[model samples]
Target chain A: MEFLSERARQKLKSALLILSFFVLWEVACLVFKVSEIVLPRPTVILGALWQFFPGIRPHLIQTLYTTLVGFALGVGIGVVIGAVIGVSRVAYDTAYPLLVGFSSIPKVAVVPIFVLWFGAGTTPAILTSMVICIFPIVVNVATGLATTEPELEDVLKALGAKKLDILWNVSLPRAMPYFFASLKVAITLAFVGTVLSETVASNRGIGNLMMIASSNFNVPLVFAGLFLLAGLGVALYVIFSLIERRVAGWAMRKQDFAMG
Target chain B: MMAAKPDTFVPALPPSAPERARPLISLEGAGITYGRGANAVEALTPTDLDIDKGDFVALVGPSGCGKSTILKLVANLIRASRGHVFVGGREVGAERVGIGMAFQNPTMLPWLRIRDNIMLPLKIVEPFRSEFRAKRKTEFRDRAEALLEVVGLKGFGDKYPWQLSGGMLQRANLCRALIHDPALLLLDEPFGALDQFTREELWAILQQLWMDRKPTVILVTHDLREAAYLATRVCVMSARPGRIVADDAVPFARPRTLDMTFEPEFVALTQRLRGLIVDARTGKV
Candidate 1:
């Protein structure tokens, strides 16, 4: 530990911290004689994950596909609607409160409506994911455009710039950092929307796998499914994070030092 | 509106000569009142001014004197409630004519590289706008580099705005404002955010740019010395519901330097303007 560099030390510390939690979980489960039906040991969950890996592959793929489709649509529509709302005061005043009200309805509750409308399958899952994830993107993009410095707008206007020119040259670029931030949040929520709908209405995906495993008292398999979903969420988050770094690294320059 | 035109004997000049010789920008009894009647607040009183072609004018007054409002009026960013604002002898229209602007903050797009930020205007304003896509990359690069060189940022165009110091950013800001070779430039306390040393340095930079191009410039500032040093004419505005109370012509010669601020006449002029602003602030006219 003493020989380790500072960054290595930090990584080691984090690893040890996470490792200690699992160690405590395994020991507590065994020592307390906790019923395996209620909670399985970390090793048992790992064993189940390996054993069920082949069977869970299709479910994992289905979940990932649905989430990605929904997220893509959410981002596409969010950008257009957000830009329209942000650019026009009349549209903003009219749409903002309605959006706020609509987003307030729990997306989980809407899953049943989606099910009734589309039946229990990928359609409901995708729509639910889109519904849950689009709000943050709209909020962020609209805020970015709405807050464009009036002075900057004046500069462009004085140059004979049309509304479209300002949006392309100034507003949209200004929204990138906000847009990327929303992507990170939206991607995570995309998973939630997918899984919630899958649990309620879909016959496929990890959500359905976990539900079936739980009913069969296969606690370890359920934990395995949860871990798989977490892994997928983390992988998607990291991909977006990498994209964010490449596209908008300049914005994070000051934040990097502060975070360190 | 009823003020009579003087009857003078005359005419060696062409009939349209007098009209042609009229100032490039004029606000004739132009004013702005925000909101509707009853609750409306008059931000600017009916004001009259004329800025000749290539003249450098500075508007100096208190915080709410509507000095910046006058800049906006000239740029046609806002309409005058009472009368007309004429640019190039025509009434100001919704469509913008050639005008460039810079503010106290650099207002550089953080996402854009310094060079691209400077090139933004050309990509929008026409003649250049229509050809920007077809022009060789090197042509745009050369123009940006030339402007950057003038601002002492020759090799730094690839850097982001965040990477530059405050003074360097302001330099880029000035370059962006001038990149289009506009007929008129509007500056709203362009150096107000910098420290004294940097502010003085930028004054020299701006002075050089103005000298080289001779665009019609209207600077709005609280710093009387900045107004006195940079402008050929300094106009003082009264506090709220602002109206110009004094329009003093600066007598300093061209290529003025920092040393000139210490000269007796420069000191006297700045002090006089300062006193006028104080009186304006106190509602004493």
Candidate 2:
């Protein structure tokens, strides 16, 4: 009960901090008589958010769909590639430098290529998100498999475990915590990729809506779009975090006891 | 590699054991060298040793004396650089199907519950591997629970290894090694990490387990008192490029206790082995 109350107190404190920031912004804008085009007041942004709620829903859904689809593809391709590279030294040595080189190319720069190939719209946004998100999964999964303790492998081999059996029984379970950690980081990158592509060439998403609002000089509507994007990102991040806690709880629990 | 003459390198057979207790494992000038050419380093010198069926043999020596190399050779974890290793009266071939092993560290998979970890070998070896799915619902789980019970960890099978103390984890590790009913068990300092009291307790547990199953066991340890207390015979090895310098039988009777370690006969045996190890380490013998 004491721990529960302490957690509640921390949540309340964080809520107040956010509330104070908005209040301070509202007061500063009102005092300076700042132009709405230059810097909209918190009250104006809230009013615009209410007015644009129905208009924004479809755009929000479109952005969510593209990010999720791209994330799924990235995870599938990343796991297969990571497992192959991790199990064989030759594959790792040959492919790791190439992967690093590919990831280093700014994903936003690839958006134009994707648009040319897929002819603009949802396809480009999804492809751009996959390009941005795949690296973390590949890197984390490979690291997990490569770092299997030598003693554990020796024990399994002594028991007549083949390479495939070891992978299925030991390596895959060991990779879960790493895979879930990458999902948290990659989900954010997936959103970034979608928004960047939507701003460049897509016509019906939150990123496009923000661009249209800015061009029309409706800064309040642009702020509303930014707020909605943040909410979506936070919501998706929370979902992934919950799944991580469920699947990889063993890794976290193992650290509590000293080795003795 | 130079050839070691067969007549000079043969290990002595156990005179006290029954005549039918034939040698189950033998190393005929078996040795290991790491790397190649100029960088090559001999880890174990060409040496011969024999262990009889149902015998508990312990290898004791100074650190880095290649005691573990012998255990690895038997398990086929690493191939010999020269000569031959035979187990169960045949050359130990490509697949080492019925061998069990445990290391100094418990080495339990942190992701698995103790029950699943103990059942892991069954998912790999022999007829059990093929029947694992059907037996998982009945026999496989029963065997795991029974082994856990033998190690005094009856209800803890549902827990992960990390939840246990180091001694408990080591006990669980022993269960995992023995779960598959392997023909031979290799232990590389299995109790080397425990506190003195825990070590003694586990010694009793291991002694009882060995008495019950009677599997051919080769234990590699740095603890001389441990070697004297548990083994039917103890072999002391020389430093680096290691070979056995002393092979002495422990003439004590079965169902031994911690009390036996305090006996004058046991003390004399430990002191003798200790002096031999000291000499071996200092190159005196």
Candidate 3:
């Protein structure tokens, strides 16, 4: 095994940071002397985490599938539609006002409507996830595409480029930095959309389990579900970030690494 | 003599040969007015002008004096309130495939490598693009490399626009403009942003490139010395709502050097142009 000096040091530093947070948390729990019913101690939460993972393995897989599929569809449609509207003036004028109007309406307010229309299943969750996740991509990508430098546009025109070539080569690549930023927002929204869908409409996914645990005051499990949801959100975020890293390798050039 | 208005710009440049060769491009009775009614300001009055095949011309004038407007009119970026334009001997219309352009700012696409950025037009503009992926990719690349080498960007194909120095970007910008070898080359102060050293370097580079390519060129700039250095003919204009006041030929030798500006003949031409510009500023022309 090749053990690099800097990598080992970074690993040690991160581990220490995480350990420090846990220690601080444990100390605060003991000093407050709170009952297990609210804000369990570090050991209690860690134990609960171990038990919950294997027990809800099937539900975990189900939630993962719905979240991924919905995210894919939302991003796919958002990018294509956003790019279309971004490049065309009439389309931008006609559709942009409508999109902005729709986006202003709260996404969660439509959760029940989706359940009524699609019923309580993966469909509702996916549809809800897509709704929550798609708008930011559209807005961000469109904004990026619309705001491309006019001089560059002139260059393309002089070169004899058609609309499609301009969009594909000039406008689209320029929009990607914006697109990746929106993807981060989309990842968090995907989790919120999926969980909200499950909480409101589904009976089999993590959302339903949380609701059942809370209504019965199975306090530990409910806290566990909350923790689990946060973890799932982090996992999804990490995945989106990885995809961003893999595909948009060019963004590394923008790494001016701000200190403040 | 038939009554002719000085305010009018002719629709076609007269045939230089006076017989056989029609101008590759010409403007007849061209006028541009911005706004309407009380607010209207005429940027350029109706004026006649012609550009023969392979002519290298410059438009020199005060700021916002419609030197650029002339370029926009020719590029069909905008239209004149009156007059007809003919490019390649045909009336300017929707099927124009014969124009290349460069701007004051070196506006290369930032995301694309320099080579690909230059290749963008070929990806879209046809004849080339339609046959791009198949028969002409190698040919297009070789052409791009050759053009790059001409502009001193031979080894920078894979680098992005951001990585290039300003002079390099401008050189790349100039090459990109002429890559397709259009019948007309419209440059709007293409070196207006560079430092003195870089600008003079590009000046010679542009002169040589023009010599090599020999397209009909109309460059717009506020730099009188620049116009004197590179152009075969210099057209001066009046202030905003601009109009051409003088269109004087340089009558200097070919392949001119920057050192030529110190010579008596070049100094005389510059002084004469400066006097006209002073007259223009005073509304005395």
Q: State candidate 1's TM-score.
A: 0.92
DockQ (CA atoms), all models: 0.74, 0.74, 0.51
lDDT of 2 by residue, A1-29 (tens): 67568868999999999999999999999
Fnat values, one per model, are: 0.94, 0.94, 0.63
Q: What are the per-residue Cα lDDT tens digits for candidate 1 across B1-285?
A: 212222322222355665557677889999999999799999999999999989999999989889999999888888888988877666775324589999998889887789999999999988789889876277877998998998889899988887799999999999999988999999999999899999988898889999999999999998988998899999999999899999999989988999999999999999898898889888888
> Clashes in candidate 2: how many?
0
- Chain A alone, TM-score for each of the models? 0.92, 0.92, 0.87
- Tens digit of lDDT per residue, candidate 3, span B1-285? 112333343344465645657777778888898899999888888878888889999998778788888887777666778986656555554435467788888878765678877876677666776777974458888889999998788899978777789899999988878777877899988998889999999999999998988988999887788999999999998877678899999888889999998899899888888888888887786
Clashing residue pairs found in predicted model 2: none
Question: In lDDT terms, how accurate is model 1?
Answer: 0.88
